[model samples]
Target chain A: MSEDITLSLDDAQALSLDVLQHNGFSRAHAEAITRSVMAAQRDECHSHGLYRLIGCVHTALNGGIDTQTEPEIVDKAPSVVIADARQGCSLLAFEKGSALLVEKAKRTGIAALGITHCFHFSALWPEVEALSSQGVVAIAMTPTHAFVAPAGGQRPLLGTNPIAFSWPRPDGTPYTFDFATSEVARGEIELHRRAGKTIPDHWAMDANGEPTTDPTAALAGAMRTFGGYKGSALSTMIELLAGPLIGEVLGHETQAAGPESTAKPFHGELIIALSPHVFLGQDCDHHLQHAETLFEQILGQGARLPSQRRYEARQRSLCDGVTIPQALYEEIRRLGSR
Target chain B: MSEDITLSLDDAQALSLDVLQHNGFSRAHAEAITRSVMAAQRDECHSHGLYRLIGCVHTALNGGIDTQTEPEIVDKAPSVVIADARQGCSLLAFEKGSALLVEKAKRTGIAALGITHCFHFSALWPEVEALSSQGVVAIAMTPTHAFVAPAGGQRPLLGTNPIAFSWPRPDGTPYTFDFATSEVARGEIELHRRAGKTIPDHWAMDANGEPTTDPTAALAGAMRTFGGYKGSALSTMIELLAGPLIGEVLGHETQAAGPESTAKPFHGELIIALSPHVFLGQDCDHHLQHAETLFEQILGQGARLPSQRRYEARQRSLCDGVTIPQALYEEIRRLGSR
Candidate 1:
């Protein structure tokens, strides 16, 4: 029963910060990292939450990411902010660039942020969610590590690139959802492998490049993009928009050029913000009403909204606590002790 | 062999215009309509091409679409073009508004176009492609008739709701694609039904709300969104963006509200145009190069680019012309002669 005990969000954040600082990050850097971790845990995104702490430590130790450097931002245009992430963690860069992004978007009706040399290590929803909370319609995209094959191809040449979009509502929780272009996230495959379960046929391909239900083989080979050509095309769009458009490494070249980018685990990120103040004006509430009408119809049919599951989980975790594997908590404690 | 006879692009355009004129469309409106039809036929988009000519005539005659008016355009902001289609065709609205869109996007680095009270009958790619050819990055989203079921629900609540994005290339063909948020296009399902064939189980659902391979049953019920919940969310995003964001009818309400507005066949359309001149500056060539590099890598893997098939078809259609059934040609001729 003790092993099954859960931790409150505040306690988890404190413990995460403590462990991160023990692993050699400064207070500011540790705070930024822990904030994202706690948010993910609150959302019950276990893969990106406390479980990623060990990976973060390993990345820092192996120079896979820098934690302390500041982002250098340049005003490319009245509506464009170009931030050189300085081979550091993405959270800090996004945090530092938020003020400029918000101000520019409000002024111009739309703004774009290109963050280069970012090592994105957390869920992307938070980035756009922050903007949506400010009543901005926001979209965020970034090239991921390559693990997905293109349609009609055997080789993995594209990232399971993810796109996140959010629209502000009057009540303000936002109609927000983040999804990987792949049929299933790589995390799901890992879970299946651990659970000794066979995945559905569309989830991935075996090492021999044939569709396989075995998660281990799927991992050894590549993941399939959802909806065949449509998802692959969307992933391709993300790679170009987040990579080359922002002057960062292409997804296919990420591995081949690893030595060229040892200190950064990610290529770049693109953030777009649109202001209802300038564009929709008084129509924001009107738009929100129509959205609610559709939502009612969806809910009436017993279909959950896009992020409903995560949202429900977040509410539950906030009321109760976040459950974690006892061994993982012990490991974090040991790291903090050191 | 006469059934396989082809006509030049000019002849096809003329023939299409003749048919439309015979059906009561003014010269200006017919020209605009034919331009899109010719482009679709040239690109070998058979589903959206000449096949829909009869339906277009019927729609106009039944007062579902108006052919005797011009769209009223208002420049809401320097970068926002709002066009009231006045219960007319989407192409005329787009054509009338294109100049303002180009000027504003060039001046502001980005622009948004909202066209309301119009019926969109052709593929969306051509809308964005028009802007891409003007050397601007473009995106377009619009709702359709509600035929798609939400992810977990059985009843149809959303449209196919297509979104199109285009990145202008230096060589001028551009990287453009348009795809519906559904698993398969309704046109394809109709084709399968006519051919007495079964569709894939994932493509649609039966009236019993079960996944069905029977195309007729699928048509009787609802089509599924492409990638389960993800596609459903994308569809929802499109519904809001193209509907209320642009001041038009929502998909779920389009049918219910039809009697309220017997004149407008469509809800609305949203067009977003961004200038690489302002955003990329002289680096436009560099960005184009990188895109081409990705295209090369994609081609090397034997994966066709999203619009490559259409492009190839267009080239061939330009050279050899489009092939239509002899019976269909006579039908068109009969309509044109009347």
Candidate 2:
């Protein structure tokens, strides 16, 4: 078989939607999820792109997601919105709730959205970037299944919690960043194990709470958080804010509630939006220009900004389409066939 | 001189207040700043405690802060409050705006406070911890003078921007964490230099953008942010949110506005407050219990929480007072003399 194949962006969306619908997801759920999948593909985020379809299908068939139910949007407070996912994937809930969230932020200067009873399986950048496109600063975070450990401990007590932030620019794409709090992704360690290579000492600790370079020992033990204790603190903050504050499951509970070794974890997400118009009032333009100057200095100093590569890939994908492994394409086509 | 002297908490507050008032600060500003100094001393955060008094006095006299002008509070929107500090210290601005910020959060579910044109010298934990004491989950961040570089760059373009988070518990002190985005404080490297020791490899970079372990070289170059690119991204987020979003100066601008080689930096601070009552409604108590369970698990695994050591020090300080250097006490007293 050929190693690779090329598909236009439209075809990628169609394939994802078909695979999701064939696995019993409703059209609304499938479309919402397909939008995120398309975005990941366009940005060249391979792990979150076509590769995620298999996990979505597996979770829909075996992980107990309520795909048939629609998310219920509620105006919880003057500046708060809640989208109860009713145990479904979070994309649809975010889609349903984010409009009201943007309006409330515009009206009240700041607002929050809580997506409860959700199964989250995508990177958070798409949601934050979408909010920024509407001219507001957005911060989004969620707690995943416990796979990483707190600093100074070997056991898995913390999630690879991710936090995303986006700032709307006067022109062009928003300044955006989304990253996992873990030192490295779980797949990185797995790849090293498969290659029979030693993992970096900072990546994980052995079962005895000692830092180890062996990939196998790291896999048996736990992943370490980025930036040592500072990253650990941030991961904990996400667990508390996205988990308890919004009446959602913690990382360990999310892991236990789903199928054994399930790729999709039942969790919650919290997104906060702030309007620059409200904060700066008439001087919003002046402040935004100052931001441009800061960006100029950063680039002038030969430093790359976050999401720069993603944006470049997005431009390339828009012009030339995306390429994926032929084996993955066949596997997805097989899953989609009724 | 004796190496150390012990003072009761009241004496610490009185000394701080006296020093500020003697150095041309209004009683209002002095009192507000003293509370934070007292809290730092009580928590055994010696660096931010009485030791900061000299710098405060120096900045008040030479750093161009408007000591006589009071902060003007504005209710910009339903959920936004701004305290234009009139070029004064941020403590007074934060003190004036916090009550309204807490009220707005409770009423609307989420709220933000912006302190503009202020000289900030205290740790952010005090502000977030104060909000948590008022039964709200709080997050605070501020941009300091540009002394650190982005992860991939060599020259300084970003601040050692600090972020602090706090969650209220049903009883006792709140769960709080405050840390700079930098790998380590600039003072850490300076201390290594004074002790004639090499700094850590991750602490900073030389002028050529290469990693350096020599303390003098690191001091002459740029401090590295914690966690490489992720920390750099977070620092940038702070620069945008607290700087431009609030219509205030960025890190380099803050440094330029203050006296050359001055210890204090003129900047802006942003604090966000969220209410559990609004999100979980009547089920707030149930969710808080879940948070306690998470805390229990973290403690059970012998992994310490972020503020555990500070709380322990707080207890000891409350029982046995606080210890400081006799030389520093004499210096402060001399500065306060008529």
Best model per DockQ: 2
For TM-score, the strongest prediction is 2
| Candidate 2 C-alpha lDDT tens digits along B50-150 | 88888888777785677878999999999999989988989999999999999999999999999998988899998999999988999999988888998
True contacts kept of each: 0.44, 0.91
The DockQ-based CAPRI class assigned to model 2 is high
DockQ of each candidate's interface versus the true one? 0.57, 0.89
Q: Write the per-residue lDDT of candidate 1 for residues A10-91, one digit (tens) a residue.
A: 8898899988888787777788788888888889888889988888887777777767787898887767787888877788
- The whole-model lDDT of each prediction reads 0.82, 0.90
List where candidate 2 sits over 4 angstroms from the true fold. A256-264, B256-264
- Interface RMSD, all candidates in order, equals 1.8, 0.7
Question: Which pairs clash inside model 1?
Answer: none
Candidate 2 clashes: the total is: 0
What iRMS does model 1 reach? 1.8
